[model samples]
Target chain A: MSTGRKYLLQNVAPYGGERTTVLLADGVIAAIGTDVTDDDATIIDGRGLVLLPGLVDLHTHLREPGREDAETIRTGTRAAALGGFTAVHAMANTTPTQDTAGVVEQVWSLGREAGWADVHPIGAVTVGLEGERLAELGAMAESKAQVRVFSDDGKCVHDPVLMRRALEYVKAFDGVVAQHAQEPRLTEGAQMHEGIVSAELGLAGWPAVAEEAIIARDVLLAEHVGSRLHVCHLSTAGSVEIIRWAKSRGIDVTAEVTPHHLILTDELARGYDPTFKVNPPLRTQRDVEAVRAGLADGTIDIVATDHAPHTREDKDCEWAAAAFGMTGLETALSVVQETMVDTGRLTWADVARVLSETPARIGRVSDHGRPIAVGEPANLVLVDPAARRVINPDEQATKSGNSPFRGRDLSGCVVATFLRGRATVMGGASCDEDVVARA
Target chain B: MKHLLSTGSLSHKQAVRILDTAGQMAATQAREIKKLPTLRGRTVVNLFFEDSTRTRISFETAAKRLSADVINFSAKGSSVSKGESLKDTALTLQAMGADAVVIRHHASGAPHTLAHSGWTNGAVINAGDGTHQHPTQALLDAYTLRRHLTGGGDPSGRDLAGLRVAIVGDVLHSRVARSNVQLLHTLGADVTLVAPPTLLPVGVEAWPAEVSYHLDEVIDTKPDAIMMLRVQRERMSSSGGGFFPSPLEYTRGYGLDARRLAAMPDHAIVLHPGPMNRGLEISADAADSPRAVIVEQVANGVAVRMAVLYLLLSGNESNETKVDA
Candidate 1:
């Protein structure tokens, strides 16, 4: 058995008691107490720093295999670690996607080799993400990959029977189906969030009810099957009510709100910049506040970075021609800190709960979302909560530089991240060279 | 001259300048020999990706009036339907020694793409893009509105100040509505958008126009012009059921029928970017009524487009020469 190097973080705030020293050995926290005398141990000062459990993301599009130029397992995982995330549920909307055990296992193995962050490969609920028929859910679940989440994320599973069957089938294996929640028929040629701006701009409007209707139906289907369902990036105020009603009825449903969805609104679409374009598009400020309130009150359970990356060719044209997605992994934590924490809607503890703890619990990742203590897995982050900086997409570590938050000033920054006693990021920068060398 | 894509960006002064120039063009149309030598050396291409008879011919007429050689490129009989890409067609047009390409594509921003894509160095005019701004349509509508409401007193030189306009119906699918809203606002008209909530695009609060669920509320404000948008049935298939519930329900709630037409102020005119759903958006009686100005809007379209072409192409000659020098 290899004994991991011991390091102590003294005076970690808001979680472990003041002046507590956390000791790590063999990937787990070995001790936490007032004093521990070890002459050979390396002690690091941690005063005025908040020790947070490693973040987990339920939605991240790691464009791999075919579209590696946009994002790869190596670059995207490094981005995740830099954003304070220790594990991310890699979406199955890749080229030759995670629709089968073979593909899922390949992505899983690539993530293991990358070794920057834990990549939990999400299997596609339908073959080719076509929304026509179910993929080999059981095979993916039982394979060496062990994908417990099934999703047709980029495309909506619009067929009711197919949705119901997927909902019912996933119950057998205790797997939760995460839905992208858009009615394709209603949103055909839909460019932006359907509202006054769409009317004014004369772009095709994508109605909120298109998304709300899907969530309403899926939540009811999950309730009927007595299964768990995770709603991905709930955007509208109407969606909040549906999810609130679902949770009130104890339907075993959890919802996630994206960092972009919580902060950005449809007003940005007026400029016709493709960077603002996204799926379940940015809605009104009323919807933004509702989503924030949802996050605060637990109506929304997680802050998933729907970190979709698109090539510049896909996004640099007219508003209608641009692909729907924006790079979110690197900016997710800062946005949450700005929109939720600095605004008094949530504290650092709430930020930790939403960004890290709740998402890990929802995805059923056991080693993740552990408390920062002895005997716990040393997956953690150090945050500089008072740090203020402007977002520069060119400076982001993600392969794609399509962040709409580019050039906007944001509060708070992630200083370092430790994944299983490994410092994957330090001093607000990704330790990519070391990880690549290790890999 | 580049094609007028969407009126959403035209200022009052710019709109007036275009309309005044169109008035000058209209004077030429009235002459026995209706042609000009200004664009005799230029070639104009009418690239219609969607079905259109009135818009295409108006553009063709406008080009001929300017004495430009006109090439009609309809998508139905062309290689576009066979998937011979837009770039290929542009190259083909370029090979034919085409000077300016006037393209009306079903895809929004298609003309903008063609112009900026270096597909052709010739001036590109947007006939229309998918539910996006139609600059010429808004200009002509403004011209017609100015002529009817202002009684031909050179309303071209002035913005629609002290004017209140209510735009009704299918705001979501109507590029005309989008262009009119922006152009009218820029020209100083207080605009209101009246449609079913489903017909309004997603984020409407940020729009300059006030949104109302009913047209009666808009009429209560006694608008200067009540522009009715044609409700394309294809939008129903895309938007799903209950877009208006029924044509009868739409007529009752939002349509500018004879009864609703009577409710408008006598000075207020009815505008439509034609091929009107006669029984749906407006009654046959109301459409032909003296207050309609629907036919006049069409006549104004040719003149306005002529002015846009002449100004954009001719007005930039000095700048082009400077660059060449």
Candidate 2:
């Protein structure tokens, strides 16, 4: 496919600023201003719409190569596009485990072939996410997919020595080890957040210290080895405190808060519905307030969609037997808008930074999270922040209908998503044709 | 009142009603023929996912005495993976048109899940679900307490008001203790839970009860009743790094002995939710003493369960008659 078509967006506010027309051609922003011409170009009426860089998810599970019953590259990326995400880092905890270069390449190419959002497959820090030995981290980094983020997401790298070594080893390739910080012994049979609710519910407790302890240890390990460490789904107030302390100490550490953790709490687990069940299970309302504060203060660097999808059989039964994840790709921006921007806690520019710039910088995804300016790649999303709707899982593009935000009113809608100067989503739906059929 | 899942949510009025109904059921049990015509054409399924012969037999005997056709569906060792079997078992019971399903699962909240998941339309009676709840057991314990300490022979419409109950041993893993604390408190009794600090859950302070680590101190208070919870020794080691050091050590700290039993008030009773760990949580001398009412607790269990089943099933669907024989 050739980038021959010229399209112009008229009167769109960039970063919620003054409205101006932006012209796109040759897979880049050609011009931005009133001088931008619509002659011989398709015009999109973007009056009153806010434009930002396409959302970048540092943590997403496009459960491909295995668990395709839940999601695939074609559908997950399409869902991401509909959510205004032009790039997502697919997590490493697959059946085959994306620990090898071949699997990462396969996933990256599959994303390319899908013609939706750019998919960057995260390499597993350990073999099969077993936490025993290191995977081919160097090989994955050097592969065609160029994986720079390694993680054992579903399982934590519990062995201190292994964690230390993985952190050090990734540094050689300028890579960062994304850790799922859970102390295994502390979280054994843990059904939900360890608090008054879990005690009343009679389910086993997953204590907040289980996550915070590991984060404390890993941040120290990262400092000792002079390497970068990324904490995945920081869910506890203690974790926020620990990360804040580590940053103050000048330790190279970055932390992400999931959209679910920012809004939902352990109170939802009272119904024993698995729809609310998630690993690093929802914490207390205090933890929710802490994470919101963390995100606002920049102690938490980004908001990543842990876009885990599971089939009906996986979540149809009792809470104890159900899978621990919630499909999040389609509702991420709306949730961010509802919790952060609409609450007057953050500006639209901060939203772009947290949801786009910071996450891209963390994942080392250079192509995305760029500013919507001239000569930059036209990877952008047009958002109608005033629009609100109740999320229905049935209408989502992901294969799994396990969205936890179902039946809740959320603000902001992705009116359109452009990946590299071409429309991946137009009119809030996936553009059926390929944006550019990559060779 | 559609389901008897947990006494935690049961109101004071509802608790008295169940105890009052059990008094009527207990009166009928004294007759030569205990069978009643209240549930003559109804069907009750004892859906025991976890093996509890005592609980199953009590539910079965209760259902039969009420003239409900009983089906003992002991689905123990069914696959717990994804709870396919729990749902499958419920659907099977639903297909059989069982009027009420008595469920005991190894996982906490399984009965609540079954009741709310819409797998079956029948009323769910939680027999025992992990360490979460055992409402009938608490009801029976309260009934026994009411009979001994409150209403004398016929504790009809009587609550255990102003009676102090000390629940001792393994408060962390004891569904009996969890159920009793809430039910006893709801019935207007002051409940003091006595256990080693390790045997108490993290959020025990929030429960509507007092917590004490020393059993002798609680015994010194001269409580009206001391309910000894069974210590599942297997759970001690298996549930994440041993909750206690040894049985001897646990006995020394929280066990009810002959001396402690003698320290109780003259009319006080010693109750144990059996199958008891004889020399561990309770001594032989105390368990066999005249003050001990362990055996009568079993008899009262049937009456309490009968009261729960009758209230849940006989309320709105009594007009529809079905005969199995």
Candidate 3:
């Protein structure tokens, strides 16, 4: 946020090909197309780059106000910047849970103070994410953070009445309640996805019907109440079919598919590797195909990095005792490129829509996920789609090194990312060179 | 074999070697001076993270007869109950310089973790682990089979080729059933798994065994041996383990009763890896019948475990190698 400084990005491919020049000035896209030059502007040679609006993550776990031993607004946002995200929706599951306006504002202010990525504190739909009682929703919606998304992500709001009431409550302020759809009874001592691998591995099964059943109930509830419902991390194929059917019947529902779900499967659970252990668990190949089809079509709305971070001690133990979730912020785009774009299923334009525009709309963040045009916010990333790198968790920026795709060679790399025209990342490294003065 | 984790991966030659060596150990047990100086200075620690007095005692006796110092670390009243983890316990034992660590855990792959994790330099022996494998139990079962089926032959370096064995009851939760199926298959035996539809695991069809729902059908095909697995009556719940109607119903369907026992081949033996459910999975009449080797299997367990400890700790080589060295 240098007020009047200009930046001239030379010869970059904007979304759908055709080499073009883009210029940023006064925190807005000053110009696009031929002969875009400014004398005083810092010139960046963006040859062999595909420019996209900086990614907007609807699901991010900034373990602040609580588990700073795992992550913080500073480190989490810095990791986000490296992943080409300009804004992220901070999940509500924290130490005290982000249930009150006081905690939400504190988290939001901390994100602003870090000045790396904009953190929108998601208000918890229930106190402590317990799913028993309603949290302070209206106050959070109107607070300084202006929280528009609410969720009890780590735990599912299993009670039909509770889920429906939360959905209806969020409707009052035009907010969407993101539901982590998992039936508690169906997953009591659940260790991993219930299937052939779980049986062979002797790990307890987390059945797919448990997730699908909850989604089936919640979608009907959302329809009956005429409120917005966002399903967080729809992992199974049956879940896709349910969401597809719900959309066909015209229910107000939007769903996200995590990057890991698109590429990984439950078969990886064979070695008892805790790195592959995650909530909603990696599923079968058929489910992977179904979710891919769902995303390829518009059945799935966006790809959100449910970027959960944990301490090494929390994840490097026995499979049954290991904490669930994979560190995802750094690998989201590359995985998407490997699974979707490189497969010729989605275009660069569609990539921006899913990763940027659609997520910004869902989280209701006006400053982010905007198109790169003259006079729009300069929140974007420069990508080299041909560049490939083998993932090494030791080299990633996230605090937790529990990346399931550690040995995987993924396509594409983010070369530079601009957060509101300020270079938060340059040359694949975090640049804290300049930003607006702290409040 | 530095570690005896499972018999599923045991080769035909390896299975024969273990059975032959177990016969030699069993021969020593009958002597008035039933002891050896083979593992004279070695220490064997029986680490039981699960309560299995039957398995621990068998290993303790085996280690003692071989002149190995024995130590029992039961989890019930130990530091394990004081929030001590498996890693800490393994480290403590490794520091004590135990030669062989016989582990029985409630977790399926705990011994596998301990063996492959560089936790210790000594040999690892899996007494039993949760629904995964009981290698020594399978070894003892195989030894019993060789003794009864060999029919006066020396039985050295020979496989149970063409031997048809049927494993009955609760195959879903029985580590004995899993290990026996694998070892019996590798030893050139055709293994059939008979259980109620609910009592079979999701991936049992992929196993190296014929899956059948009718125990009556398997009894009709009875060629050599029928091993009965224990069905935990406590696991007879609705939400979790597996579905079994009632003890009476299971006894009626899958249980080995006197009438079924009488119809077996004259040489065909009835084996139950004891702490048997007596009348539930197997009737008392069948368990006590002359054909039943439940008690003998217990005695053979000590002998088989002695061979496993000897083979695994002494480079898995032949007794000839030891003599030449």
Cα lDDT, all candidates:
0.82, 0.89, 0.86
Q: Tens digit of lDDT per residue, candidate 2, span A1-439?
A: 3367778999999999999999988888999997688687889999989999999999999999998999999899999999999999999988789999999999999999988889999999999998888999999999999999999999999999999999889888889999999999998898999878887778889999999999999999999999999999999999999999999999999999999999999999878889999998999889999999999999999999899999998888877888999989889989999999999999999999999999899888898999888999989999999998899999999999999988999998999998888888888878865443451
State the DockQ, from 0 to 1, for candidate 2: 0.61
Q: Across residues A258-304, which tens digit of lDDT does each residue of candidate 1 receive? A: 99998899889866677899998999999999999999898999899
Candidate 3 Cα lDDT to native: 0.86
Backbone collisions counted per model: 20, 0, 1
- Which pairs in model 3 have colliding backbones? A54-A380
**DockQ of candidates 1 onward, in order?**
0.33, 0.61, 0.40
Q: Candidate 2 DockQ category?
A: medium
Return the clash pairs for model 2, or none.
none
Q: Which ten-residue region of model 1 chain B has the weakest summed lDDT?
A: B316-325
Which of the predicted structures, 1 or 2, would earn the higher DockQ when compared with the native? 2
The native-contact fractions of the candidates, in order shown, are: 0.49, 0.48, 0.22
Per-model root-mean-square deviation over C-alphas: 5.2, 2.6, 2.9
The lDDT of model 1 is 0.82
TM-score of each: 0.82, 0.97, 0.94
Accuracy of chain B in candidate 1 (TM-score)? 0.92
- Which candidate leads the pack in lDDT? 2
